[model samples]
Every structure is written in C-alpha cells, then in structure tokens.
Target: MSDVVTCLWGRAGWDRAAQGLLGAGRRLADELGGKLRTIVLGPADEALVTAAQAVADSVVIAEDETLAEYNPESYLAALTAACQKFAPRAVLLGNDAYGQELAPRLAHRLGGSAAGDAVELSVADGQLRVTRGVYGGKATAVIALMKSPGVIWVRARAMAPADAGAAGEVERVRLGIAADPRVKAIARHVEAKEGVRLEDAQLIVSGGRGLGGPEPFQKLQALATAMGAQMAASRAACDAGWVPASWQVGQTGKKVAPQLYLAIAISGASQHVMGIADSKVICAINRDPDAPIFKHCAFGLVEDYEKVVGPLAEKLSRHS
Candidate 1:
C-alpha cells in the first residue's frame, strides 16, 4: 500500500470528462508515488469496471440499486464515507454539474480545501498547485493547497486521456445511503441530440449573431454534418433563441478544446474566446475585416457568412 492515495470519483458510463479525470488521477498518483483508486457508485457494470481498470490501480465499487439515478445527497453521503475510509491524499471530480455541488461539500466534510475548473495541476514540495481561469476567463491564476486530501474539480478537455495500461483490481465497498426528504427527483428528461457531443468532438462548427437568424444555422449544421463535427453557438445566438441553451459554448456555457474550431460570424468576445482558447486551430469567418475573432484565430475570412457558408457547406458535403 502506498502512503499517498489519489482517488477519482467516476460516473457510470465513463464519459470523456470521466476519462480525463482518470488520466489526471493516474498522473497525480505517479507524481506522488501513490496509488490510484477510482470510486464508482451504482450497480456493477462490466464496461464501467473495464474503463476504470484501464487507468486506475483499483476500482472501488459502491453497489446499490438506489444509486442508479443521481441524488446529490446520497452521492455526497457515499463519497464522504469513502473518503473517510480511504483517507486519500487527493480526490478528483469532474467540473460538471454534480462535481460543482459535491466537491465543496465533500471538502467541507473532510476539513480540506476544494478548487474547481482546474486546467493544470502539479505538486511540488508537498504542496498541490492548480492553474485555472479567473475573471470570466479573462486571466489565469494558480492556487496552492496546503491541506491534505485536496479536492479538485477538473475542467473538461484540459487533461489528456489516459492510454490503456495494466488492468487494476476491483474492490467492493458498502455505505449506508439515506434518502433526503428535502429533495426528491421525480423525473428525468434527456434532450435528444444528433451527431457528436460538443465536448467530445474533435471538430466544432460554431455560429454567432452574424448568421442573421436561426434559419441560417441550418447551413452551419449542414457544414457540421458534412465535416462530422458538432454544432455549437455563441451566447448571443442562444440568447436570441436561435438555438437551444445546450448548444451554447463560452465561459458561461460549455468549454471546448476541439482539434479544429470553426467560428462563423462570431465577434470573439472575451467570454466566448475563453472557451475555445485550448482548441488546436481556430478558423474565423466574418464580414467585418476588424472582427475580434481574426486576431485570435489561425485562419480568417473577411467575407459575408451568407455568401460563403452555403458554398462551403456544399463543398464539404460533396467531398464527404
């Protein structure tokens, strides 16, 4: 057993963010000369176990039918128990909705500190340091945690996914789950989405106010379909009701780090640019020569989006 322990809390299906957390946990374990343990709540699933074993040194499963659906109170109670028993040096969670709520509460229970939306993590001289954006993603700040069992909420697409390695052992843990009368989850509704998920897409085609209206988004969607990419929108487009809120991408929306990001008619506001700062390449299309997106993009086309988007879509569709 290692003196230092790094624990990662994973969801059932193991989405990209979960994979990223596992990858980050593995690296942290290596850095601290510790062991990597993944904690999964819910019934046993082979796929979940397999995914967890790909990167973890051990998979700790808290099996229960009640865990099938997400209940923040129940999850918090289970996690609190696990952390107490495991006494990990660090705990990592995704910076998603659940994590945003759980991390701070868990840290409070553990008498430790919590940090969210961490883009970079490192340890030196027995202190864990995290780098993240501040001021609505306008700048960066590095935070150092002096306490043990540091709780970190990792940002999506910030860390590299862990490659397949030696399989890990699976351990089962039991925790008492009590229902909270304060909150009850009556129903769950999932919105239907087509094509690739925005966060998981390697290529993203985003539209902004320059598209004129929602009807023009169809052209962008066609381009996205042709390129096998996900379609996204700026806050302006979402606020204009041209697209669903789920399609928005910015500091106020989902953060993306696609390999290639296409910004059509977006003015590249600071809030919007902050989300795609990690994209490997950015291509901007706007009619205004002085559009702010041009400065931050690798490729720029100062042509009317109406004239160019249709042709571009056609070209890609033919090739595809």
Candidate 2:
C-alpha cells in the first residue's frame, strides 16, 4: 500500500478550516515520506478541483446521489471507499460536527485508531501523535496512534491554510453508496445568520451572564456592529435564554479562534475559556476584579459593564 495523507471536504464545500486541513495534511505526508490526497464529497466544480489540486498531490471526488444530503451513513461509506482505494497513512478531518461523527466510525470500519478535537499533530518514530485540550481546557494531553490510517479531526483555526503551488493529479471515483433507510432526513432547519460565522470571525465581541439580562446584549450588539465584529455569548447567557443557543461559545457550544475576542462581563470559567483557547488575543471587561476571565486575558478592565459599554460603544461608533 502506498503511504498517503488524506483530508476530507464536507458537503457545504471547501472552507478556511478545510484549507487548513490541507496544510496540516501536507505536513503529515511530508513527515511520513508520502503523498497528500484530498477526498471531496458530492460534486466538485472546476474551481473547487483547481483549488484543491494546487495543494494536494491528488484529489479524489466521491460523487453519489446519496451524498447530496449530509447523512452520516452515506458519508462514512464513501469515505471508507476512498480510504480503501488510497490506502492512506493518516486521514485528517475537521473537528466540526461532520468530522466528529464520522472519524470514529470510519476508523472502526477500517480497523484503525481514531481521535477528535486535536489541536496539534506530529510524527515521531514514525507514529502519529495528537495533542488536544483536556479537563475542560485546564490542561492538554498528547496521545500516539499506533494503528495504520490514523484518523484525526483537527480543531478550527489550528494553523494557516496551505500555500497553493503544486500541480497535482485529479480524478473522480463513484462509490455506489446508498443512504441509510433507517435515518431519513425529513426536514432541515437552517439558522439564519449575518456577517461572518463565529468560527470564522476575525473579531468577536462576546457577552456573559454578568450582563444581568437579555437587554444588555443589545448594547453588546451595538458595539459589535460598530466594530464590524461577530457577537457571541457564554453558556450562562445562552442558558439564561438571553441569546440564541447558536450564539453560545464554550466547551458545550461553539469553539472560536478569532484574532481578537472581547469578553464583557464574563467570569471566564474553564469550559468557556476552552472555546476561546485558540483566540490570538483575549480581552475581558468585568465588574468583579477577581473574575476568572482576568487571569486568561491579555488585557482586562475592572469596571461596571453599564458604565463602560455605553461610552465604549459610542467611541467605537465615532472612530468607525
């Protein structure tokens, strides 16, 4: 079997995180003395193929009617087929929902090892090692996968996207995989969103329970709007019904790695800090001087949010 490092693309198509996977995959392949391959689900248009071809040594398109809807079973089957055909040394998937569900199952089907939510990867003594957060982001742990075709789902914004240059091979493979009859997608509800997604936001303004109630989110939103940043909430705010569940960011919610994360009135519990661990710069403003958030922030201000938010919003609006 030829040694290869494989990365998978999801149903929605190639995103920044997926591009980051290519960069990571390319590194893994180089360390293993192998080639980098990418498997794209559904139809891959000319633009998609051209883009992927620039980084990967080869690209495999797994096209099937069942692949249109994101059914775990169909995806797993197609991915299995690709792995069997490619005989990769390792398979990298995104840490998002799609990869979280498929990585383990694909490993089980292929009789290999599996790990998820990995932040770092490396090859030592020809074995694949994965580094990930543990204890709700209080610490980190590293594990080595001894099995062939080590399956890993990488965290978002783990690294920069692969630099494009290679003129790689491209081919399409049809896997006659059918959807699982037991799990029919009867309906789909897409959350309406504006501006950049939380995972993809460069600047983020997040709030917490200390804001006292849902009304404070309006002020936070105003600041976010003036700064052209996305708004997020801690679990407390979401649990208190102050914001939509989709806006929550924490261990139990979404993980973000923005360039700047401005946390207002947040206590910065470990679970919440876990989500923003990858953020480049963290800033906190809380009335409580001893709030846990101050410990983790690069810059912190101790002041009542009511007194600080209005002026901050006004100043930011003026500057904009």
Candidate 3:
C-alpha cells in the first residue's frame, strides 16, 4: 500500500496549499514508502490542481456545485469515497479545527482507530509507529497499530515542508453527489486575513499587562510592521481584549517557533513561556531585574517597555 495524504488547499483551487500543513504531510508521505496524494474541491478548480502538483504526487478533484462551499458532511462523503476506492496504507490529516472534527468521524466510518495530535511518526520494525504528544507536550506516548489502515491528525505547523521539486505529478478524480444532512451553513462570513498570522511569522514581539492599555498596542503593531514581525499578546493582554485571541502567545494560545521572540513588559509566566520555548532567541524587556522571563532569555533589558519599544522600533526602522 502506497502512502496517501490529502492536501485540503484553500478553495481558489489553484493557490499553493497552506505551507504549514504541507510540511507534516510530506514527512508522513516519505515515511510511508509511497507518494502522497492531494485533494481539493471547488468549481473550475484548475488552479487548485496546478499548485498541489508541487507537493503531492497526484491531484484528486471532487467537483460538485454543492461541494463548492465547504460543508463537513459533503467533504467527508467525497473524501471517504476516494479513500475506500484506493485503500491507502494510512491516511493523514492536519490537527486543525476541521481536521480534529472530521478525522474521528472518518475513522469510525472507515472502521479504523485515529490518533489525534500526533507529532511524531516513524517506521520501527516495519510497522508505522505514531507518537502523540500527551499532557501538553510534557510526554510523548507511542502508539502501535496492527490494523491494515487507519487515520492520523498531526498538529498544525509541527513539521517542515520537504523539497521534492521533480517529484511533482498531477491527476484528477471525479465524484458524484454526496448526501447532505441536518446542519447547513446558511451564510459564510470571511474575516480579512491581515498582518502576519501566528503560524507564518518569522519573529514575534509581545506585550503584557504592563503595556497599560489598548492605546499602546497601536505602537506595538507599528513596531511589528517596521520590524517585519508579528504582534502577540500575553494572556493578560488577550483577556483585556487588546488583541484578538488568535494573536495570543501562551500555553493556552498558539505555540510559535520564531527565529526571535521579543518580550516587552511581560512577567514571563510559565504558561506564556511554554508557547515560546521553541524560539531561537529570546529578549525580554521589563523594569524588574528579577523577572522570571530573564532566566530563560538570551538577552534582557531592565527598563520600562514604553520607553524601549519606541527606540527599538526606531532602530528597527532604520535597519529595515
């Protein structure tokens, strides 16, 4: 059985698959000793086919008028149909909102067990061994599967994309209408995709309750823009609603592995530190010299955040 993983690329159909998911998909593909397959659904989705060719070996299309808009049931129907026909060794999905909800249901229908939020996978003694992070990344529990085929949902942005320039290939799969059930999305509202998302940024600059209020966040955003960095907030600032929940950086928020992390006025709570432990370098700015963040930081500034943010922003502007 060849390895088969699906790329749920954004709906324009031609745009490149989300870079974050591509990494884990490629890793699993190589480990499984087979080429990866990608799937996208849309109307006139020629572009979706074109872009997926770069990462996956084959492009499967589920083109239906009703399927143009994403309804979980419709997608599950078409996807399950495809997998049953081919019967891949294993199926992989991202640990995203959609993936988390769909993978378990798909596994039940396929008559297999699914390991959620799997961060590690390897070929040990011929069987596919999966490692799932348990207790919030404190320990990794290994899972062995004896069954023929199963499903897995790996965490978001956990793996890096592999280079397979010449291996790209494309194919098409046509599907008939799938059943539509009780729940229906009557309307779809799309939020504007703005400023670097937490997943894609190379660097993150964060502020905490020390920033005073929502007014200072404008300056932080300007600094983030000038320095080509993402703006993040500690749980405190996020609870205050100075920034969106999506921008929160902590154990409760998105974990980031940026090249650099700048902490201004942050107290360095362990909850906050957990998310940023993967950063290449950390620099904390706080008035107190004994702040806990300094212990983990590579650099430290014992000064008021309001004072340093402006100067640092200026210096970054000049260098940029």
Candidate 4:
C-alpha cells in the first residue's frame, strides 16, 4: 500500500493549503519508499489536477453533488472507503475542524494509530514518528506510531510545498454516499474579510486586550493597511467583542505563519504564541517590560502602543 493524503477542495476549488498538504504527503511517501496518492473531493478542475500532479504520484478525484458541503458522516464514509481501497501505509489530513473530527475515528475504523496537530514527521529504524506542540504550545512531544497506516492531521504551514514537476497520473472514484437527513445544513454564514486571508498573509498586524476597546483596532487596521498586511486579534479581544471571532489567533483559533508578525499590546499568552510559532519574525509593541510577549519576539519596544502606532502608521503611509 502507498501513502494516501486526502483533502477537500476549497469553495473556489484549490486553495493555498492544498500545496502544503501535498508537500507533507510527498515527503512522507518518499521516506516510506512508496508512491504518494492524493485524494481530492471536488470538481476535477484542470488547475487543481495540474498542481496536484506536480507533487503527487497520482491524483484521485471523488466529485459528486453529495460531496459539495462538508457533512461529517458523508466525508467519513468517503475517506474510509478510499483508504480501504488504497490500503495506504499512512493517511494525512489538515489540522482544521474536518481532520480533528475524523482522524481518531478513521484510525479506529482502520485499526491504525492516530495523532493530531502534528508539525513534523520522520522515519527512523523503520518506524514513523511525529512531533507536535504540547502543554498549550509551551513544549513539544515526539510520538512514534507502532502500527501500520498512521492517521495524522498536520498543522498548516508546517512544511514548504513541494516544487512542481512533471505531471502524474490521475484517477476518479465514486462512493455513492449521501448526506444524512437528520443533519441537514440550514445555511452557512461566512465572515466578510478585506485583503488577504490571515492564513495566506505574508504580514500580519495583531492586537490584544491591552488595546482597551474596539476603536483601537481601527488604528491597527490603518497600520495593517499601510503595511499591506492582514489584521488579527488575540482571544481576549474577540471574547470581549472588540474584534470579530474570525480575527482571533490562538491555540483555539486560527494558526498563522506570516513572514512578519507584529503584536500590538499583546501579553503573549502561550496559547496565542502557539498560533504564531511558525512566523518568520515576531515584533512586539507593549509598554510592560515583563510582558511575556517580549520573550518570544525578536524586536521589542517598551512603549505604549498609542505612542508607537500613530507614528508608525504615518511613516508607513508616507512610504506607501
């Protein structure tokens, strides 16, 4: 059996996360000395097929009207059948909601081992091991999978996407699965966001509770605009309704790995730091010298955000 990596296409077909997923799969498959077979559940658009082919040995499409929206039961069934057919030595999925729900159950169904939120994978002495954040991202734990067909949900931005190459073979499958009537989806509401999605942004400007109120976010937004970056928030700001829930970034919120992450008045809780651990460079603007965020950032300024943001925004605006 080869290594099987499965992902559902984004609403517009292939999205940014697709490349990283396939990249991880490619690495694991190469380490295992097996072919990488990626299972994508969406329309087999030419662009998707071409991109996946560049990284995977084979690309399998499972497209049907029943598979349009994400229903846990239907997706589980589809993945179960696909894994069984492929008889994969390992299975990889994203660490988002879908993977968190399905990974353990899929392992149970397949009689394999499962791990979640993995950031690293390797093979040593013919055994597969994974490294993941522990204790709310303050520590790391390495786990070894002793069973065949290890099911793993990898964190986003954990690996650089594999470079494109010659196209590979493509296949199509049908599961004839249907959504359960008991769990019909009424409607879905997506939060409207301007500029780049936080996950894809190369730069980010984030705020925390110390900002005092929602109005401060406007200043951060202005800084973000000047810097050509996305805006995000800590959980405290979101829970207080100072920022939209979608803007929250923490262990329980969105994980981001921008080239530069600027924290404004953030205290740097471990949960919050965990979300930005992958960031290339972290800078903080907090008045408190003992703020935990200072420990994690490469650059730190002990000044009130109000004193720094306005001037910084003005300077950046001039350059822009």
| Reference-based TM-score of each model | 0.91, 0.95, 0.81, 0.95
Backbone clash pairs for candidate 1 read none
Superposed by TM-score, candidate 2 places the C-alpha of residue 109 at a distance from the truth, in angstroms, of 1.4
The RMSD (Cα, Å) of candidate 1 is 2.2
Clashes of each: 0, 0, 4, 0
- Identify the runs in model 4 with alpha carbons over 4 angstroms from their true place: 10-12
Sum up the clashes in candidate 4: 0
Please write out the lDDT profile of model 1 over residues 1-320, one tens digit for every residue.
22233334444366677777888888888888888888887665677689888888888888755565678888888888888888888888877678888989999998888988899889877888889988756689999987777898888566888887958899876676776666689887787967667887899999999888999999998988888889999999999999999998987788888999999999999899878887889999999999889888999999998888888889988987
**Full-model lDDT, candidate 1:** 0.82
In model 4, how large is the Cα lDDT of residue 115?
Answer: 89
Off by over 4 Å in 1: 1-12
User: Model 2 over residues 124-222: C-alpha lDDT tens digits?
Assistant: 887889998898777889999989779999984666677899899988777899778867888899989787889989999999998999999999999
Kindly list the per-residue Cα lDDT of model 4 for residues 1-320, writing each as its tens digit: 64656564535455656777788888888888888888877566888888888888888888767777877777788888888888898899887778889889999998899988888988888778999989777789999988878999988475778888847798877778776676677899977768778887899999999999999999999999999999999999999999989998988898898999999999999999988988899999999999999988999999999999999999999999
Question: lDDT by residue for model 3 over 153-264, one digit each (tens)?
Answer: 7655656655646356655556786659766988877756876667557788888899988899888878888888888989999899887777788766777778889998
- Candidate 2 has its poorest 10 consecutive residues by lDDT at 1-10
How much is 295 displaced in model 4, in angstroms? Answer: 1.8
Residue 188, candidate 1: alpha-carbon lDDT? 78
